[model samples]
Target chain A: MSDSVPAASQSNRGDDFDRRDAAWYVDRLVHLLVFLGGVSAILFILGIFVFITREGLGYLTASFSPSEFFGSIEWRPTSDTKPTYGILALLTGTAAVSGLAMVVAIPFSLGAAIFIGELSEGKTREILKVLVEMLAAIPSVVWGFIGLSIMNPFIIDAFDVPVGLNVLNAGLILGLMAAPIMTTIAEDALKAVPDHYREAAEAMGATRWQVIFRVVLPTAKNGLVAAVLLGVGRAFGETMAVLMASGHSVNMPTSPFDSVRALTATIAAELGETAHGSEHYRVLFTIGIFLFLITFCINLIADLIVRGIRKK
Target chain B: MTMKIAIETHDLSFWYGDFQALFDVNLSIKHGRITSLIGPSGCGKSTLLRSINRINERIGNARSTGQILIHGHDILAPEVELLQVRKEVGMVFQRPNPLPLSIRDNVLFGYRLHHGKRGLKSSERDRIVEKALSKVLLWDSVKDRLDHTATQLSLEEQQKLCIARLLPVQPEVLLMDEPCSALDPSATEAVEELVWDLRDQFTIVLVTHNMAQARRASDECIFMLLGKVIEHSETGEMFVNPSCQETADYIEGRYG
Candidate 1:
């Protein structure tokens, strides 16, 4: 019986069995490629952070004053006599516009998300999702143009304000811009909740509305909050649209009709005019750093909230 | 004593988008007894169990032509309210799925749904929670941690809590689709014992893949194959003197 055993099997043992074939080499190559692809994202983010800090470091250390930067509204970067670098007006501008944008966007985005994720079915859900994504795909520049041409005239005509471009115009435009992405993220959050939770709740005789309000909402609350925070981040970082529709004036916006300059708008409007390595240029970069930090902190909080849900 | 019918299905046929699962399934389950539905996989046992409470409709394109009577009322009728049907017939899934809430809230969820949250004193809610937990024999281990999340419990405890949450609504028929399948042997034995204890209070329709569990835990046994009922008899009679060749073949471990 031992002699009858195949000679090919005996010959192929040990060294031959351990041989790496073409497929093995290909698999290793693909693994290395994927690993590099994953690492590149982190590398690019770090590179951007380093570049921004290097450009802004001079202003942060030497000429930066806590009271002038945060406590006053004077932001005359090109003044021949003692340029003022205060950003209080710009900070309030961003805050007022983004806060108002959130007030306008939250209801529309969350309602659309619930409809898409929980209520609609089959083709209707698919079509609505595609439409919302298409809304997000519209260029930010085009949104700024609309704020300039359409909402500019409409706000003046309707609200009877002096200038068409102000916090109201910028806020309405930014809210519309932010709603689509918020809807998408909120919908994903609602979808991430297991279908088993819905099944269990429905089996317990919960009405459709009751299941959404009581069970699904509570379970997905963290993700929903993260979605809203991401929307806030987007509103804060937006520059071109806010610049166009906010009338590009530096002031503490006391009402929706008052024109104001956002932090991002200040950097965008001044960086090109300033000579390289000058205090003006560095101050613009300093504003860039501040914007970066605010967005980073918002995103970190959103991530932690999402991670809290995963731990449970 | 005359047997009271808790559930009766007349010529029930179901389809999942033209692929029929249950074909002309007729059954009469007695009240206040445990009836175990035993069959191999893909024999439509779970389908039948889910159909009792009309939960099968949750799957889009699932349709049925049947008359399901519970306590002499045709629950399949268009006029029948789904919430009312679900309140009368509760279900437990193969895997335990506790809501992401406190154990106390999970126990009170159904009660609050049926009886509005308002007008209920804290003492009354606590009493309801304690009684339901005690019925499932879980109060002793978890009495002190009532505010803890229900999803944090062990598998056996979660399954017990799943069953306990159904009691506050006072469901007459409890449908269990392989409740112990996710548990280890010892947990299975404990859950089986709990089911046996519940037979005196609720009419339980248990769908199990484990033949030994059907023999040990149920009063009546049903053997099904290819969506057809092969045998329905007392547990002892079915094991010893099965009337159908298929039932004998199945019980004797000849073939599934």
Candidate 2:
């Protein structure tokens, strides 16, 4: 309570002065700038999502029900009269092609990843890794071109179909395009697992395959799921490859050999020809919303499954 | 009543890409006894333990020469399958590395690997789990949460679970490479108690830097310096009466 109190308060005042120095202000200013920089991309993405939703919401009026958008298969947005906007055909086409692509890709990519991560060594492993990365670097348009020029004819000859551009053809091409990415990601996941797990499993007398499937794969389950989700995402949103490979016939895909049209191709082909802010243009935005929602749901479901595995 | 030799390595030498790690390690480990390999850091105690089960060979460039005989079978023979060798000798690592799986699954991991999954009934597998967990004294704490992930357990419990997982396979020998090095003092003592309890059933070769643990836990002790065995004697004799100057220096804590 005596003179010591004033001395302590004087030191506190000096500390406050130090806290408000030029260096401190500059540090805070830099931090703010970095924080703003980090958030700008997220802000732009949110802006796009909100803008698309605002434009798309007009189509959900009395003239167009949500069921018409989701339930019907017809997609004739340009018909002067009786224009039907059913997206079921396109949706089925996307689903079928993407599903088939995953089925074709998962086994081969996972096996290749395991082989590279667990089996290969020295120059062989190095060469395989470089080749996989190079495969990933190939342009999507080139993959589309390859599918159209080479695979279409092969499929047309093999199945004796009049049209080579079908769900199977598109799916096989998508699978090939997605393989390098899936293998690279899965291999990274496998290699990231601590060596201790491998040693423990091998010590328990597990064969290499057993160790890979039982220990390594399960340990890296989250990353593996991420790899598959990213692969499926790439296939689902692909426009050029699916458009070039899949015959643009808006029909319900009854079989793998049936020609189909994906939602992305429809938008790409029609958006340029439609009048701005017209009903057809707004419907395209609605389709964009659908694409966004479906991809969002797939990611959410995959995340939940990965979380469940982690919890176990 | 001389015990049978459970494991024997004759002139065993190991190399990692031209850098020799183990040089002419010759020793016979007796059945149903605890033998501790004691040494300073990088003294090849852990290397010798791994070589017994061919775990050292997992490294990309690691190569070994000479014979390792287990139960009268030469494991280092060209015809001998590494799978068979590994199956016969189980190992535990320094860190508790339980698979990201349920506790029950971890216990049955080795069992299901050796025996096909369909061959064993639920009740049989349950019995094996209970037996193994009880052996390591981990049943009471984790008995309620068998479905919980093994990683959720404490370091002590996880280490115990790691030991329990090795039991279902009925391995002839168990190699522990500084298993308690990652544990606290209390957990180290607890694991040492479990290791002592496991004696006389499975042949145990433990690599440890702790002189106290070697003396208190192992029946026989092998002291190494720079990849060469300095002395192999009874624990009490090694501690009370060390023959080699290096062994005496290590025991006296003159320098590691």
Candidate 3:
């Protein structure tokens, strides 16, 4: 009996060690797969940065005048004899459209978020949430088409503008496009705030509106800032809707009613026609670089602010 | 011969959708005394407490068909403003739920909610904050950092601040739902002492699962079972004298 017991015990130890070895190998394999996944994502972003910079730098090196490119108000890249690559006009057009979009988007989106997060209940809340998400799923081209058909005529008739397609038309569409993301993020932030704060405020005899404004909004302040920054990033980067709605005029726009061409629209419009590896084509990449940097900075600041809020 | 009643509930029945959480609860709580509601989990002690200030209405589909009266006012009346009822009766939750704001701001929040923000000068706010903090016995520890966020304090301090914030509104009654459940034994004792001190000024109703805490801290004890009140008596009498069978079983650890 003693001999049989020792033999069984020895075999159990061997099986245990083999099981542990198998577990170790599986753990290592999972670790390797996760590491590769992370690295590949980073590499893709870095690769885009490198390729854009390499192509864009050729223009700067080949007698591109930084002063004229930045300071002047003309962007006639295909002017045959003297293709002035001044992007000031495009920059202003981009700024005007994005600024107007933000002005139009912030209030409406925040109100929607509050309604969804604080006021809606059960079936209504769920349906509203899903509807907001569906808004985000609509294609940019559809928005552009809608703006061209419906909004253009409305703006022309209502405001008596010379042309239906202008900064105002494009900005309103862009604002619509940006509103979904803003609503989603702001609503998430508002919901993330614990219910206890609301209860405490209510227990102190604060009205529902007062509780939302005083307790919930202040607690979600950083998140709201992040949401706005992210919305700005989305509006600034949007291309197709603005392209179709704006009249694509290469000039510095001074009013919401003026026809204008954004940097994104400029690139989308010109990149197809320009000869490959030419100075003009390279300048387009430079504009791409500028677009990239602006979006990157805004997103980075938003991410940092959100992280700080989460830590607190 | 006439005892003042702080809170009176008549035929109180509460439901969460089809599920009844509380049933026909009739309770008359005396003024200036601490009453502890003790029951097993799911016996609806917390629900009963939350119903007093209509906080239960926050849960979607949760309905109540009953009359709840605070100081002779029918809180469930259609014309009664919910804000006024909440102001008269304050509640502390199971967890420490100080707003993510400065310590001073947390104390002044209730006051500012009832009174407009611009009406109170900075000096007056400071005085109110100081007095409230001092009442909770947190003044000495947090006085140096009134501007600091309330969340940065220890859990005990946070719970105290939660209680302190309610005082500025001068609530006639305080409802605590397991206020010390999140604290250590020593902190629990300190909080119980604070509750005892505040009892003279406010009618305090506390819900606790800890029978020993209910016995040691409360002036009156209520035992509930399966969403029904088993007994309500003086703390000593409830513990020492014979009572309902379920109360005896629960106290003797025979069954929940």
Candidate 4:
């Protein structure tokens, strides 16, 4: 009986069990494919940083002046006598528009997040979440179109401004563009706070508003700060909408009604017109590097704050 | 002599989105005593505890049809204030859930909710914090670091803090739902001792899965099976001679 069993087991151990079959090779192939998919994100970011730095290196080595680039507002790059590439006006415009966008977006997004994450139940929450995601998916170009056609006319009619395409128009458009993503992230932060905390607070006779303001919001404060920072990053890097709405002028904007030009808008509008190896092209690449560094730092800070909370 | 009933329930039935959890549960828990509800998993003990303060209504589809009276007041009535019901009846969860605040603030959280911050002096707040923390036997350890976050404490201390936070409200009934299930053996013993100490001042309804815990810690024992009370007697009598066959089967090693 032992001999017969051994013979049967040997026969059963055919090529499928003894050797690597098709499944083994397919598994190895999938492993390699997934590894590449994970590593490609880091690779793309590094490649873009290197390429922009190389393109801007010529201007940085030869004619770049920190004071001239950051202090002066003159940006006449096509002058016959002398060309100046100072970006003070562009910096102020970007800062103003982003600052104003944050002011407009913070309350709306936080209120929406509180409603969706804390107040609403089943169907209302699901529907509002889907609508916010759809709003985030709307293209920046379409937002630009709205800013140019609808908001421009409304501002002109309402405030009696001579030119509607100014800081107020662009800031309002960018604020709307940033609100959906901010709302989604803030909702996620509020959701991350455990339900038991709410239960404990409610069991202690706290009203709904008291529970939210005292316990839930305090627990999710770090995540909320990260969400606001991410929204600021989004507002700072926006180009198409700001270009279409900001009137694209190189003026130091002293008021919301003054026309201005952002750094991103300047790069987008003038990159195609400048010669490939010219100083103007290199300066635009330098602006790209500045933007890359700012957004990268903001995201890094947000990530660190999130990781801090996780560690706690 | 008659025992005063702190919490009385009549014809209590509960459902969680069409799944019936409790059917016709009528119980009168006496004041200033530790009554334990012992059963297997999904026996509706926790549900019943949550229903005392009307906190079960927080679940979206949870519904109950019954009269739950706390000190002769119908808490389930429409005109009854929910905040008032909760203030009079405090609950402790199986898992320790201290608020994300300092130790002082956590102890003062319920007090601050009931009393606004406008007229509350800092010295008065400190005294309240000390009194609540001292009641749970946590003042000696955590008094030095009152400003530290409450979540940083050990699980045993966190559970103690959870109890302490409920004391400032001065609730008559303290409903504990497996308060020591998350603790280690030693922590469980400490929490059980604390619960026993507090029995003289507050009526405690403890839900426990451990039969040993029910046998040792409770004054009155309640045996439940399949959402119905099998027996309710003195802890010694219930353990010595359980009247119902189902109660005997559960108490013994036969089946849960």
What is each candidate's DockQ, to 2 decimals? 0.82, 0.72, 0.77, 0.90
The per-prediction tally of clashing pairs is 0, 0, 0, 0
The digit string of per-residue lDDT tens for model 2 on B134-202 reads 999999888999999898999999999999998988888999988899999999999999998898799
Residue A141, model 4, lDDT: 94
Docking class for candidate 3: medium
lDDT of each: 0.93, 0.89, 0.91, 0.92
RMSD score of candidate 1 (Å): 2.1
| CA lDDT, candidate 3, residue B184 | 96
lDDT-based ranking, best first?
1, 4, 3, 2
Candidate 1 per-residue lDDT over residues A1-312, each given as its tens digit: 989876776655676777899999999999999999999999999999999999999999997898999998998887888889899999999999999999999999999999999999999999999999999999888889999999988988998987989999899889999999999999989998998888988998998899999999999999999999999999999999999989989999899999999999888888888899999899889889899999999999999998987886
Model 3, C-alpha of B206: deviation from truth (Å): 0.9
- Kindly list the per-residue Cα lDDT of model 4 for residues B101-174, writing each as its tens digit: 99999998998889875788989888999998888899999889999999899999999999999998899999
Which run of 10 residues does model 1 chain A get worst, by summed lDDT? A6-15
Error of 4 at A31 (Å): 2.1
Error of 4 at B148 (Å): 1.5
- How would you encode candidate 3's per-residue C-alpha lDDT over B1-256 as one tens digit per residue? 3568999999999999999998899999998999999989999999999999999888878998889999888899999998788889999988999988899999998888888789798888889999999999999999999999998999999999999999988999999999999999999999999999999999999999998999999999989887888899999999998379888888888877
Clashing pairs in 1: none
The TM-score of candidate 2 is 0.90
Clash-forming residue pairs, model 2: none
What is the Cα-based lDDT of residue B63 in candidate 1? 92
